[model samples]
Target: MPVAALDDIRAKVGQQVGTSDWIEVTQDRISAFADATEDHQFIHVDPVAAAAAGFGGTIAHGFLNLSLLSRMAADAMLVPDTTRMALNYGLDRVRFIAPVKAGKRVRGHFTLDGVDEKAPGQLLIRQTVTVEIEGEEKPALTAQWLGLIFT
Candidate 1:
């Protein structure tokens, strides 16, 4: 799918635009993230402890789930030729609704919330994102994200 034109993109507001990709959240990935962020909480780093504690196993950090947004957004947006560049502006409302256990499979769903012209060939888009964990009732994260695109 090519990137939508500015007008077409704007027209996407109030429309659901969704994409999903399978990603494995492994213990190694979680541990690496923990090391990078210096967050070695037992629930996130100690599988044995976490399992014994009834969570089943160590879980990925909430921020780790948040960090996956860019990857998810790429899957959901960034269609070929839709934009020359897409810059992550920031996020709006974000919530960690559920724990993402290590070794779990997760994907994201996106909906276009708003779009605005920034320049002749640029647009600002607001998208709502939900990171869904396989078999989980609640999503891992829910966030309103922003991005700038050069058409």
Candidate 2:
């Protein structure tokens, strides 16, 4: 994607930036996340047990779902043309509202919330992200995400 002017990016504050393409949260992906995090909870790795427990089947971990924001942002975020790099600053708030079931598809809707000039050529950008689960009434998660953009 082509870079955008800083003014153009700033103008997007308080408006929806973009919606990312849907991403399938498969069992394999969940298992991989469980392995990486060493969190093999039944709800996340054991389908039969999870089904018996009323989750219907294995579900993705909340952190796994949260981590997917990186991929989602790459597909839909706006960047300043003079940017040297962008860094994950930190999240101000994050809430996992619903579980993401295995084999379900999810996508992110991003809205630019605020922007501050932290330093010369350095900007702190805040975005509100909502991760929607396909065919679900409620979103999987919502977060106030932060990024440090170095121009």
| Top model number, TM-score | 2
lDDT of each: 0.83, 0.93
**Model 2 Cα shift for residue 147 (angstroms):** 0.4
Distance from true location, Cα of 119 in model 1, Å: 4.8
Task: Name the Cα RMSD for model 2.
Answer: 1.0
TM-score of each: 0.89, 0.97
lDDT of 2 by residue, 1-151 (tens): 2368889988999999989999999999999999999999999999999999999999999999999999999877887889889999999999999999999999999999988999988899899999999999999999999999998
Q: Give model 2's TM-score versus the native structure.
A: 0.97
Model 2 misplaced regions, further than 4 Å: none
Against the hidden true structure, what lDDT does model 1 obtain?
Answer: 0.83
